[model samples]
Target: MNVLLIGSGGREHALAWKLSRSPLLGQLFIWPGNPGTASLGENIPLPVDDHRAVSDLIHQKGIGMVICGPEAPLADGLMDFLADRHPDLALIGPGRSGARLESSKEFAKEFMLRHGIPTARYRSFGSREAEEAISFARSLGLPAVIKADGLAAGKGVVIAQTREETETEIRAMLEGRFGQASERLVIEEFLSGIEFSVFVLTNGDQYILLPEAKDYKRIGEGDTGPNTGGMGSVSPVPFADAALMDKVRDRIIEPTLRGLKQDGIPYRGFIFFGLIRVQGDPFVIEYNCRMGDPETESVMIRLESDLLQHCLDCHQNELNPGSVRVSSSHAATICLVSGGYPGDFEKGKKIEALPQTQPEEHIFFSGVSSKDGQLVTSGGRVFAVSCLGQDQLAALDQANRLADLIQFEGKYFRRDIGFDLK
Candidate 1:
């Protein structure tokens, strides 16, 4: 089957790599893909918002399936547009209603509450409710979490440590700190726990859980400083044992699926559950309509199933518990970023060179572009170095080593990826 993957990031590159290996695949096409993805398939320079152009190309290329790798396209009703215009085009993504789980934090929290899913206490507020939002934050106390109600490229959340800080953040958000994304806000009570990511492939009621992963979201070492998209990730999370996984499935995942079904929402795609374990119990932190970046680089490395087959199963509404297969081997990914990432940074810096990688190690580009015959930085996150190993320690070691090999003027990466598991 011919597939058209949307997005230009580490997650899409990893998906492109895995999907390329499937024998069921004929040709792969990436829309606005990076250099890493360009190596695996034909990269198309189509704008994501140009639905007419995308539709025309799909028909022209006879693309069998459309796999959306990021949340923005999903939130923009890309699936609905395709479904309405070209009903025969197999798509691996939820429509706009289902995408609300990620596009709007307020909607997700309310949906969780309505469905009795385990999550932190949160109150959604419009800009006019700034005073109420502040009062709610004070009630929750310091270390409160202030999140922009709409998507803000993963940087919409702020973990304020004091009442004053919380108030200030609330005002900033309401006053257009994150533009229209912050017109509304959701204030959450800080839940102390370690965070991890859970991905599931679902076709409405039927679903298959993929490998679990934990990603470091902070921009600095020791998990200090502001949050970035993701600095690093590890699959087969050491702390997510079977017992805790049972709780997560029953208390969080099951309830979420049931809620979606009961709400009459049509869903057929990846559901990324942002979870936090508090005293061995899992609570949902957020939901993503698509796979998580950096996490995908790690999780895809450990996926043993044919990626194309799984997507087909979901599209045909045949997804089952046994449809997914994952390797027991550990996987790790270290994200190399431009210096001063998650903040201001320069782009188009020449990439002097990249070291040769072992068979077990791989480099997935995120924010890189080929200029004239040389690669250069184009975004904050530059590349994700991924490696598979017999154990988590070995995987981290290999990934860290390979990450250090990539050379660029402002290259920087956290040396302590997956350190907590150690």
Candidate 2:
């Protein structure tokens, strides 16, 4: 069937790449896609924010499914608009009510507390309550998790390790560190644990688990410094054995699905459980209405099933657990970014030294534009080089080596992508 994929990032590139290989796929169209996606499908320039225009094109092109790859569009009620216009259409993201889980940190916190989902204790404060928020932050002590209540790309969160840092972050957020996104803030207690992600495709009640992954968010090595979109990721997480997964499924995943249903919110799309394992127990860190970026790049590589078929099953409310498949091998993704990324940086740099990847290695584009017949950097992150191997060490080793081969001016990447696992 003809499919329309929204967004232009590494996550979308990974999805498009996997979807292109499906035998069930017909015409695949990526809206405002990057160069990598262009090689796999027709890249259409559509005004996604203009919901009517997008829906009109979907009808014009007879697209059977619409897959949203990012959180912004989903938070903007894109799915609600399309579902309203085309009730029978397959939409791969949730509507506005469901999107609040990611769009508004306050809403998610309330939902978790109300539904008895395992999560950190948090309190929300409006812009006027900066002092009140600061007082709450002190109560949580140092290493407080301060989050912008609204969408701020993937960089809305701050884990302040010091009291000064905590107060500064809270004040900055209240005073508009992220514009309107930070007008309201959610101050959460810092949970000490190793963080990971769990992905699933669901029709509210029934669901199929995808590969779990862990992404390095900090721009610097050793997980220091500020968070960028994502520096790198590893899939089929080594620590996510059967015991922990069972706790995650029962304590977090099942409760989440039940809560959504009890709230009477209709959902049919990817639900990314940003979780942390604390002393062998699983606790939710956040919920993303869509898949995580660098994580998606690695997770998609481990999905052995036909991507299109699984999505269709969810849309048709026929998700069969028997049809789901995941690779036993490890997968790794190294996100090559502009040198001064997570900060001011120049774009339009020439990219060269492109390598002919082996069967296990692949490069997925994130942010680049074709200028004067050359691929140039257009955004902070440039490309995601991924590799599959028998173990985490081999997968990350191969991915790191390939990451070095693809060169660009001001290119930067972390060599210790999956090192934490080791």
- Prediction-by-prediction clash tally: 0, 0
TM-score of each predicted structure versus truth: 0.98, 0.98
Clashing pairs in 1: none
**lDDT of every predicted structure (CA atoms):** 0.91, 0.91
Runs of candidate 2 exceeding 4 Å displacement: none
Residues 1-422 of candidate 1 have per-residue lDDT tens digits of: 99999999999999999999999999899998988899999999868899888888889999999999998889999999999988788899999999999999999999999999999998999989999999999998889999999999888999898778988999989999998899999999899999999999988788899999999989888888888999999998888999999998999888899999999998999999999999989999999999999999998989989988999988888876776778889999999999888899999999977888777788999999999999999999999999999999999888878877779988999988888888
lDDT by residue (tens digit), candidate 2, 307-372: 899999989999987898888889999999998998999999999858998877989999888998
Worst 10 residues of 1 by lDDT: 316-325
Model 2 scores what on Cα lDDT? 0.91
For every candidate in turn, the CA RMSD to the true structure comes to 1.0, 1.2
> Clashes in candidate 1: how many?
0
